[model samples]
Target: MEILQVIILGLCLGFVYALMVSGLTLIFGVMRIVNLAHPILIISGAFVSYWLFILFGLDPILSVPAAALTVALLGVLLYKLIFEKNAAQQTYSEMTVLLTFGTAMVIDGLLAFLFHNTQRTASPAYATDAIFIGDIFIPLAQLYSGMVSLGIIVVLALFLKYSEFGIAIRATSQNRTSAELVGVNVKFVCLISFAIGCALAGSAGSLVSFVFSFFPSRHWEWIAILMSLVVLGGMGSLTGAVIGALVLSVVSSLVGAFYSPAWSTMVFFLALFLILIIRPRGLFGIRTD
Candidate 1:
């Protein structure tokens, strides 16, 4: 029963992790830029939720849409002021790394100055609530987060499948020059994609805050995990991200249950390393070029 409970908990947590990785994967799919600042943007969203909760007693879930919209606008501004300008002058990949790294540092400094280095948590009344099914206990917060993550993934998949702008974004991602030639506004598509990516990050961050305690400088740890998940899933594959998160979570949970908690973290990276060795492009990754 304990093992079963652990597996269920891990899957719920993994779904949240997938939501974070999906944002990174989406940006990579369209722009081929890793956007190292992705974690910083997530932290920014967390802070936004924190402030909103602190100021008005609003639920983190309730504040998520506003935070996501704000982050989306910030993403557009970033694309306009930095990425778009740099893309014109040099290789997009290199510039993306440099610019995003710098942005990450800037965000970290600002957050540290404002929020301090201590851990912060969004503790709602139901944070510690749980449910029992047969002999297993499940956390209510984790279940809620999982459901929200699933809903977001469904909406995103639908958008990409049926929306006109989403189709344009996909076309631009597949072939930017050809897309532009065919009357798609490549620049606009890139900006919109970036915004959508950041918005997803914001929503995920808001949801995650309900489950995890966060410090101002904690973004790097999450960044490393997210990057590994994205790479293991395939640089730009959404479904791959979801699968990678599940695989890593299940592996980590089983290891922690059978071995030591300390080994759980290492297990994820070990799995990632082994997967890369066996399948260089990842489990579901399709070679674009």
Candidate 2:
């Protein structure tokens, strides 16, 4: 029974985790740039939701779209002002790593200045409520957030599979030069893809607003978790990211149930290590060889 409860909780949490890393994966898939600032953007989205609730009594769920749009615009600005410059350079990959890391620090400082270092969470009416299924209890916040995350992922997947722009993005991901030669407008695709990624992160953050306490610096912890999920699932693979997140989340939950939360935190690294040893390209990553 305890194990069942833990698994249920973990699965719900995993959905949210999947949403959290989805945008980063998309960004990597489309642009091949590791947006280290992704974690900070998520926290920024959380703050947006938090303030919306505090200032206007808006529900976190209702705040999601606004948060997503706001962060997406920020993503556009980042791409236009910073990422676009050296995007064609030979050192683009290595440069983006440093650039994004710096961007993360700047955002962290800005958030700290605006919101300070204090932790905050949106407290909706259902924040602490839970549904009981026999001996198992499911937190309402987690369940709702998980459902929303899943819904978004489905919509995103469909869009990627069918939409014209989506096809362009996928083409760019597969081969930038070929996409350009086909008149896919690679620049526009990159910009829009980055924005979409940020929007997803923002949406995830809004869901996270009620489920977890957050501060600007909390992104440091989150980035590590997200990177592990991305690597475990195969960087840039949306399906892989979700699967990895679910696997890691469930394993972590089990570890916590058997031992302590602190120990559970180590599960990401351990799982990542084992996965990399077995599959160097990640579970979904394509092998060039």
Candidate 3:
């Protein structure tokens, strides 16, 4: 029963991680530039939620959309001021990597200055609530986060399949030049993709805050883990991100349960190294033009 509970808990956390990775994968798919600031954006979202909870007394779940909107706007501004102009240059990807990394450092510095290095966590009344099912206990916060993550995944999949902008985004990602030739606004698509990607990351951060402790500098750790997940999952595959998250989370949880918590992180990185060795392009590599 205890083992079963751990698996369930791990899967719940995995879903949230998958949601965050999906956003990173989406941006990579369309832009071919990994937003190194993704985790810092998440940290910003966490602060947003924290402020909302403290000021307005709103639930973290309810504050998610607000965080998402704020991050989305920031993403658009970033694209226009930085990424869009750089995209026209020959070294767009390399430039973006350095630019986003710099942006992350700036954010980290700002957060540290404002919030200090102390650990903080968002806790609503239901944070510690749990449900029991046949001797297995499921945390309410994790379950809620999982459901929201799954819903976001489903909505994203359907939107890509059905929405007009979604189709345009896909077309642009598949071939930017061809898409532009066919009258698709490639620039607009990239802007929207970046916004949506950051928004997803924001939402995931807000949701997970209910169950996780965070510090101003913790974004660095998360960025490393997320980068590993994104690469091992396949740089631009949403489903691959989900699979990678599940694999990593389950392994980590099991290791932590049987061994030490420190060993769990080691296990995750070891798995990532092994996966990359076996599949150079990741588990679900998509050929981009």
Pick by TM-score: which candidate is best? Answer: 2
Assess every candidate by TM-score: 0.96, 0.98, 0.96
**Candidate 3, residues 154-176: lDDT per residue as tens digits?**
89888987999899988888889
Q: How many residue pairs clash in each candidate?
A: 0, 0, 0
Task: Order the candidates by TM-score, highest first.
Answer: 2, 3, 1
Q: At residue 130, what lDDT does model 1 achieve? A: 90
Of candidate 3, the 10-residue stretch with the lowest lDDT total is 280-289
Clashing pairs in 1: none
For residues 119-155, write the lDDT of model 1, one tens digit per residue.
8878777789998999998888888888788789889
Tens digit per residue, CA lDDT, model 2, 1-289: 9999999899999999999999999999988899899999999999999999999999999999999999999999999999998898988978889999999999999999988989899999999999999999999999999899989989999999999988989889989999999888999899999999999989999999999999999999998999999999998899999999999999999999988988998999898888889987799985532
What count of clashes does model 2 give? 0
Higher lDDT: candidate 2 or 3?
2
Give candidate 2 regions above 4 Å deviation: none
In candidate 1, position 225 carries an lDDT of 86
- Local error of candidate 2 at residue 61 (angstroms): 0.6
lDDT for each candidate structure: 0.85, 0.93, 0.86
